[model samples]
Target: MDARRDVFQAIADPTRRAIIGMIAQKPVNVNTIAEQFDVSRQAISLHLKILAECGLLNIKQLGRERLCEAKLEKLNEVHEWVAQYHKLWTGRLHALKNFVEQEALQPRQANTDNKKKTKNIHKPKK
Candidate 1:
């Protein structure tokens, strides 16, 4: 059985996420990717390795250089996960809006009723 690593764990590091973003635009060699970061080449290599293991990247050897390419399909998992919460928060916000509108209307309605009661009390009986 192929054990799939969690894409979230691989992308948890800021460097790894940056690396993914960099390669997403186009394929790049390890040295090119390393140059963009403050970290050492070894550190960048480790990040690349984690990303590959998580299925977020595809590394290939072309001539002497190892090229890293992004396999963005893996990100669909992350998107699906976030979409659930997006829907939940949207529902919660709609409920909050309805509550606020109802609260606003209640005060106006109560004030109108109170005004009518006050006018009735002050009026002389017919």
Candidate 2:
């Protein structure tokens, strides 16, 4: 798979998602991260490998133990994509808001016009 696709695929799993959240909160070793999940340490190691390959996790070799930290730079692509859709929805919502306001005012205007018409029709000749 391509680099971006690999990253997206790796993140699609709930276990991987939880791992990312945990690492973002604080850097920890594979064993520490594995404790939080029911899976084996080896499975966690595999997930870590995918995350590291995807550039989402930074792995540092601190002597014998490797620590993992959330890299987050690649995540900006997700932010930018969502921001584009946010603008489109915001515009649609604004249009809906304007339509609702105009619709609400229309009844009041019709009532006022009816009142004026009645006053003009029933008035005694001066």
Candidate 3:
């Protein structure tokens, strides 16, 4: 079986995410990307490996230089996963809002009914 890394695991690192963003605009030389970070070039290369495994980054060799390009379509997995939860939570929140509004109105309705009852309470004839 092909041992591709999970996209979620790959993006969990802030550095990797930054690298993806940096390369997303345009393909960047591997050395240029390494220079932008405080970490060693070796460290950046490891991050690059994980991103490539996740199918989020593509590395190409042109002459003696390697260029990294962003392949963000893989992130649709993350987006679809998040959208499911978003829909679930949105429904829950809407239900909670309706319950709270009903609870709020019930108290006002009860007070109004009580006031009307008190006004109509007949006094015993003197």
lDDT for each residue of candidate 3 in 1-126, tens digit (9 for 90 to 100): 137568898889999989988998999999999999999988998999999888888899999999998999989999999999999999999999999999999999999999988887865657
Full-model lDDT, candidate 2: 0.87
Residues 27-110, candidate 1: write the lDDT tens digits.
999999999999888998888888998898999999999999999898899999999999999999999999999999999999
TM-score-wise, the better of 1 and 2 is: 1
lDDT ranking of the models: 3, 1, 2
TM-score of each: 0.91, 0.78, 0.87
Q: Write the per-residue lDDT of candidate 2 for residues 1-126, one digit (tens) a residue.
A: 245555667668999989989989888887789899998888988888888888899889899988999997888877787899999999999999999999999999999999999999999999
What lDDT does the true structure give each of the candidates? 0.91, 0.87, 0.92
Which candidate would rank higher by lDDT, 1 or 3?
A: 3
Off by over 4 Å in 3: 1-4, 120-126
